[model samples]
Target: MNALTPQPSHLAMVPFVSVANMLKIVNRIGPAQMIAGIAAYLEDDFRRWEQFDKTPRIPAHSRDGVIELMPTSDGEIYGFKYVNGHPANMARGYQTVTAFGVLSRVENGYPVLLTEMTVLTALRTAATSALAAKHLAPQGATTMAMIGNGAQCEFQALAFQKVLGIDTVRLYDLDPAATAKAVRNLAGSGLTVVACASAEEAITGAQIITTCTADKQNATVLTDNMVGAGVHINGIGGDCPGKTELHRDILLRSDIFVEYAPQTRIEGEIQALDPDHPVTELWKVITGQAEGRRDARQITLFDSVGFAIEDFSALRYLRNQLSDPGEYIELDLLADPDDPRDLFGMVQRARP
Candidate 1:
């Protein structure tokens, strides 16, 4: 609290994790270990998935991009994220995607933690991908092909390395500089990084294939002849309608796994398929109710569209990590009065 500003009751204050503090949290824990830690939290949440409310994200679409609100609750606590995806922003010297989120108590409708999620989203997205692969990827998978080396490329490589024992990453992007940037970032991460010219070359000898292009149209980053049997495809780029990365034929060949079937049917790679297409919910697989990786020759696809439960788990992990003393600041977010019904008086008292 600033000394010059009028101090409100404790109930009016909320812990706010700024971008700098978020970076502190990530660096203090180490990226790979933090990704693994978040993956563990995700597993715990997924086990009790039915305990929380679930729904598709509410999105406002436009010609340039889309903005979305993702909300969920676990009876005791509620969390929501406000995020936007503007692929054109990259060319305009801005982030293609940015986000912020809040976690609040259910007993009283007050925010407990508010934090920037642009960085956290990248981490949680990678963690979710790694967590799903842990259940669905081919056993003993050593190499991964990361197509579209954008903001998420290095994080995915590090997460797979820490969580799934992947040692080699082959990267390819429409722009050579993007691949170079990812290669430079992953140099000292104890992984053999290879920059490939084509997606076909990137997938050679790679047990896992990750597509994360940032186009807002139906672009086939991977075709039927390109993807073979026994490879786990992590579809990360297809988070909105008409913005898909994999071809329809691949979805037909692969055993699709998704966070929420309803959301995936609308926003994920499965959008190209019929409404009744069969897909295994990732929670069911994590809870051991459904099968993953049925056979070595069977193709597995995690059609991830960044669900609300995953973000909720990420906020839970961040709150836990900040339980100890840290540099996070507090903001006077709520208007608290001595009498619950005297909200107007609270404002009047601040007129000095």
Candidate 2:
């Protein structure tokens, strides 16, 4: 190499986990175990939640979908995810959500890892819900009512099973095909799976109700009359402005928990309530700074809006797993010049 041109080295490459590699990693670790690992990272970070730089995701809304960038930093490392939500995409044979993420060194502002996040987001979202339920749900709760059987349904089912010892899942969706898909996917997963005709039927005898429908409107997937006392609700789907899954009356009666108050108020089911509505911070509960469930009869709701720190935690977990060479490829993403000032010379040398 010339004095002005440095040879490529590990420092000049970024670890990239493609969708295929992600699948291989999931298969190697197993989905439920991978989710549990992510949950462990999430819990550790949330316990020290005060250390993170948190902000509401930046979103650009369109008639068809919304694209968002969720970013956060824990002083030493920075992470962000690029995600899009397009409910209509499923009708055209595409996923409703897709995402990719980057984890970087804060000191040098250089990317350390890049990975597909569409599957990782689902895993972390489910893990976060299960972690919240571990704190807020009634102790020894075994059954969950999964009220939407979309891409997130099976992940939610497995997370609850792995994290909270949930043994049964009752599934319901507006589309019978979606419910059927969940039934097919969860077959022989060691949990009793029941496909129900309606949301009401799904909630029958269930202690945890998880609503994850993908709609861009204020849709009441769960009504106050339908939810009984002593149940924990995981509100997962209504995660943007003008979107919600629970009735306002249910919010008025439940002890609501949220990730970050400012962002959840704008993007969660709590958006239906007053801006200053009383809600518990989940990190406080995890850290024992606040109480979770006061009584079995008290209904608890986790208004999950999918925060950036959760994505950061997920990226951190994925980056840690990159020690397995089979799970990733190195990308020639950065330029390394022997002379720091010879950027043009470095470019000219590549013209061969």
Candidate 3:
């Protein structure tokens, strides 16, 4: 069907990059470098924002957890991830989440990379959070209060410390063990970590308040009274229709910011606000089309729903970084029959 000289092969070769390879790649590049590279690509994509085929995230919700699919492409490369968030997974000796993703070319529909996305998601989520905070948080913000101490807590803390000039993190969670784990992970990073007993204690005098709790309901992790002026709230966990972290009154009082208006309208903290309520897109701030932090008294909230373009940027970055010899394992997703029209003969030859 291609009408070319050499017929296509039945075995289409694609590469599979494993978790260890990814770890090596990420470690060599470092989180700061990766975040910077991803930010540059995100800005470039935002400049040509009209070229992308964007769609809302697809989510499947159950009583215990939710699974989501986020896909996006720019007519050249297509990427999608299958990730599940089950808070109870840890109770059963499994991680609270697991994920995998595929990056494919659009022309011939050949997969270029298939990698585990569980760790990758943690990386990207933190990168996105820091990216937004960099644009929205007050200049020279050094202290942060991380309200959730789950698996993502350490990544978020490091991203902010490395990218946003944050030097101290006040950590708190319902589970003291989780907070202890986060503190231990951050050891030797030259950053101070304070494990507070309550959310109120953690948030006190912090420059940025990051709410990343895993509850899948409309829970108020950040209340109106706890939030003060000039605080940049990075809301990462409330990313579903029924899930939220900030109280509705806080959203009404703060200057809300989001990734994509349409998608965030349903999934972000904006879901609690009226449809007509005004909010700014993070891309606008990145492009210098809109103002971020104008005054010390104005509270800014980044209602992050983890947009597809971020993943696209990340996969693009990962693919570029792993361009050395034999960084991935090749696979055959399609079978080639040597002759385009001799499919029946090939099947007959394989009858044995």
Candidate 4:
């Protein structure tokens, strides 16, 4: 450890992965492989869903966007993520979504890992989508229509390709440049990338359709008329109240699966339905407690409003990746004293 890096002898140092180091990790592992790795952890956690304490995310809503804290824990470990969604940020030359997260031991309440999650969140979100599709998408689904080609477009495309053997991604965005950007990024991804003129064109032969626009309203990115039978729709952009992508009729016709029912009922596409609208939690399907896809003709929708467990799994993956110490730098974020009661004295003694 560098001398300038905090090393309080009394405290357990937290390993922090900065944005640059996170990029290194991703570049080292490759995005598709990282998504697959995180998906494995997600599946592991979901299979043990009964062991976790779950709740809705706490959000602070503003006129421009929303910020939220998603938290969850098993008996042995705890984790949380600080995330925000601001649709206008893209126009302002900033990220529409940004986040950071931490994972800590339940026994001592000391964080073992702290990492920048903006990039990690993107990877995990893609992994979760792919995991859901692996269970719910049409069998042998080889093509996907990506309706919004923004920050998450290529990740979704690549994930579906990596996880579902999707060979073609048809891209469309209200802004044509977004589609062009996706086409550019996915050039060497080994999947067939086709830039389409419209949403209808994008879904031409797609068995799976993923709508991930960044608008912060009840925009009908996908109307009922557009969605065909037997198509698996993945809606990820409707992550807050009053914001949705798919039409209510589409949700009514599709067998909707969600991360957490309570949170999804408030912030997912299902929010457009009645309070008593029935849905299945994805964990049940992962754990074999509930059915995923009953037939090839069933329209399955993963109304992904992202849950805390996925973040916990991602943070856990990051923490476990510590076989390489250089992947993160240590930070003295906690104030532990030789004597538990001498926190102030410990601070005063570090005057140099």
Candidate 5:
């Protein structure tokens, strides 16, 4: 067979990590270690933020749900994630969010890796939140109030414990079953998990508050009076237009940090603020170009909207871990023909 021939060769196969393999990878690496590994990659990329091509995620909104494409590149590799958000799916016995992603070599524009990102997204989101908290949260803060106990609750709790040395997490959700589920999942995690009766009780002694509700509207999950001095609020649930968690007055009193200003202005907790309202970019804090946590009394807020570069970092990390042969599967994704230009010949040969 010639170089372009349709032969069973490794060149025509792409490495893919399915949901099962992804779970195995996480199990092998351990969830805390995986979160830390992804966080290290995220920190390295954010420090060299200027080297990346960044853009706001492109979204298509419908009455019931939304679909989005988040893409970014670092000159050598390009990555993008195809994700959907359908809050109604949970009631119908499905995950509210599901995703997959691709990593490609920029030179030849060939895909090098294809993997399920639903689990990876949860890992990266929690890692990114912990990374931000490391910079913005008060030093020696150990307790976190998780306002939403859905799919992301356990991940967030573990990430904080692993990255920020948090030992306790107070959980609260509108649905009591969610709190019960999180409590069960976190049983052996060595964390002091408490199911709170209300949001006020969740934040009683917690220094960090994470809001990750699945609602798609501007719900005042955390009001102004609830938040107090020296608390770092990680607002993750307010990730799209018309979706937010905190009250506007709380935003007015806090030093807001965000992934990207342009995107956060439209989709994050800062969306409640005026267009000219000032916010700090989280990358700058990591790079030491800007300040984080100016004082203990200052309320710090990370208006997280899940940026493309974070997904790019996750894809990059996954590609780096593919050296183990058994960690992934190969799929015949490319067509090869005896002649580079003879695409029709390859199709004809496959016909019985």
Candidate 6:
């Protein structure tokens, strides 16, 4: 260890993993607490939302499905996720969607955490739902109707329970097997789960309705007649351009809210509404700049398109739980030059 010997000046890198490890990390904190924590973080970010560089998510739509890139930063930390939604992939032993995300520091433009986001997406979507419900749902929303009993169903149920104190859930899906799977996954959770024969049967007397179906078209999961006063509908599945859950009449019947209006207008349930139709953004309600749930009888809808800020909040939550246990892969993407003018020499020397 001579004084003249120069040690590596860069920080260590982080390795990404599959959804298996992610499920354990999120479970360790408990989904409800995680959602509550994430909601607070979201509030803080929304207070300064104007500081971030917001962009419309980038989407590559094909005949089969759509893939999207959502990137955002508060001029300090940058994060992005590579997620593909292919409904046909379920039969191929793969999820209909697959995802991974990177968290990077803006100071040196280096990634701090590279991890799987499929599980994180599920967790964050639920958190986002509860976050919106915190502001939009009527007082004492104890019952929730969960539509689409797929991979996301369990997380949404737990999040609403943890974040909004929901104790009862009614489940409905086109496939009875899917609903059975959801009930089995949620075994011993103390949530009163009722399997319903139809979407109308599930949403009958629920305070909150969550739609997470995987259909790639504009399917009407909820119509105007099915909606009740003071119910907060958390629409999840219809996230892409051509996909939607709630009918146009349902949106027209409720005070629809969204994460980012400019982006949601093109992707959220608001896509079916008139261009000039009025709606409130979630951040505004969170910051108290706008009113939420004006009365107990006002119908509300949180048309969730799943914004990047929620992912930013989720990444930050994961970063806090990690202690950098020396678990990462180091890639040499940048070269250290002995002298400022020796850049080319450094590259040539680094070549095999």
What candidate 3 gets wrong by more than 4 Å, as runs, is 1-11, 341-344, 348-352
Give the clashing residue pairs of candidate 3, or none. Answer: 9-336, 10-334, 10-335, 10-336, 11-335, 11-336
Candidates ranked by TM-score: 1, 2, 5, 4, 3, 6
Task: Report the C-alpha lDDT of model 2 over 8-98, residue by residue, as the tens digit.
Answer: 7677899999999999988888999999999999999999999999999999999999999999999999999999999899989988899
lDDT of 4 by residue, 1-352 (tens): 5565435763657889999999999999999999999999999999999999999999999999999999899989999999999998989999999999999889989888899999999999999999999999999899999999999999898899999999999999999988988999999999999999999999999999999998988999888889888999999899999989988899889999999999999999998899898899999998889999998788999999999999999999878776677788889788878788987887776666
Output the lDDT of residue 9, model 3.
55
Candidate 4 wrongly placed segments (more than 4 Å):
1-7
Tell me how far the alpha carbon of residue 52 in candidate 2 is from the true structure, in angstroms, after superposition: 0.4
Per-model C-alpha lDDT, please? 0.94, 0.94, 0.84, 0.92, 0.93, 0.83
True-vs-predicted CA distance for residue 312, candidate 4, Å: 0.5
Model 3 over residues 141-248: C-alpha lDDT tens digits?
A: 889999989988988988898889889999999999999999998998778999999999999889899999987789999889999888989999888888899889
Q: Give candidate 5's total backbone clashes.
A: 1
lDDT of 1 at 288: 90
Q: Clashing residue pairs in candidate 5, if any?
A: 4-337
Ten consecutive residues with minimal summed lDDT in candidate 6? 324-333
The pairs that clash in candidate 4 are none
Off by over 4 Å in 2: 1-7
Query: Higher lDDT: candidate 2 or 4?
Result: 2
Query: Ten residues in a row with the worst lDDT in model 1?
Result: 1-10
Model 1, span 168-242: residue lDDT tens = 999999899999999999999999999999999999999999999999999999999999889999999998898
Q: What is the C-alpha RMSD of each candidate to the true structure, in Å?
A: 1.5, 1.8, 3.9, 2.0, 2.1, 3.1
